[model samples]
Target: MPASGSVSVQSLDQFLAEVEGRAFQIARIATGCDQDALDIVQESMISLVTSYSDKCESNWKPLFYRILQNRITDFHRRKTLTGKIFAWIGLKKADEEDIDLLEQIADPNADMPELALSKDRFSDALIHALEQLPARQQQTFLLRIWEGLSVKETAEAMQCGEGSVKTHLSRATQTLRAHLEPHYFSGDHHES
Candidate 1:
């Protein structure tokens, strides 16, 4: 086929191949459902191709991350609003179980035994503890610590001040520490 534009299909394929896994990881954490996460990633890919394909390649990472985060936040807002409306209509109970945000934010691959071999019960507890964190805190923790993004990059992706990023990360750390204190510092815990 004749070339239609300056941005070649090869370049787009390369970009998608490089970032697809991490994009899915971020979406999974943000949405808590694998299928929803996949949808967000796919949508983000479409948006990137449609709107920003002509931009310089160096700008792709932040632009993609920003789009992904916005999509995730929108999904959460819609879900929350719908739940509230349902409750108001007496179609759902107000006392329904709260979602574990931290568990939602954790990378699914991290659950593998190669990373940590905690008993199934301990792993389940940890997932529960993570789910209890606020959305921003969980995002901060995952982007900064898990994805290894710098503070500035994380702030940009989150569309927040650096101070806000630090605050969220600090609060997330404290909450996780408190939740894991008994296991983390106990004598039974072995240092690798």
Candidate 2:
């Protein structure tokens, strides 16, 4: 945990393990595809190890997130470019691949079915709400609030000013709260 020395292999492995789930979640929220998200997270982790492993463990969090953010951006750009090129060539994409993530993760190995079901639904709703956010807002909220990074660290990871990070987080929080409050807190569902 030195300020400048490279982390040991064990420490690096532990760090990757600790952040893997959240990283996957962040990438998933960004990509909206389970396989794409997994690829982005893996690429980000490898990029971090190859490029920034020489940095200190203390620096890894922000650096790894920055790499992740860049990778997500790159993924989107590539998708867009590929789509345009395909259209130009008169080639069309395959059928839509909308994945029901809830179904994909429904069978959690939890002993308490009631609690697990409720928690899973809420988590799913939260993720859906997150998907509705703008890119900057989503990244800011994930890095600053969900991932427990400081404002300064989030700013660094997002390549934005601290004020921008705060603004994005505020907007994202309000949007998510408005989206999820009624569904979770109301006494009755307002089914349309």
Go through the candidates in order and give each one's C-alpha lDDT.
Answer: 0.77, 0.86
* TM-score of every candidate relative to the true structure: 0.73, 0.84
Q: What are the per-residue Cα lDDT tens digits for candidate 2 across 1-192?
A: 445455678888899999998898899898888889889989999998998888878999999999999999999899999999999999998866857553344455577666676666678789889999999999999998889999999999989899998899999999999999977876333222
The candidate scoring highest on TM-score is 2
Q: What is the lDDT of residue 21 in candidate 1?
A: 82
Q: Could you tell me how far off, in angstroms, the CA of residue 76 lies in candidate 2 after the best superposition?
A: 0.8
- Model 2 is weakest, by summed lDDT over 10 consecutive residues, at 100-109
Off by over 4 Å in 2: 1-4, 96-112, 188-192
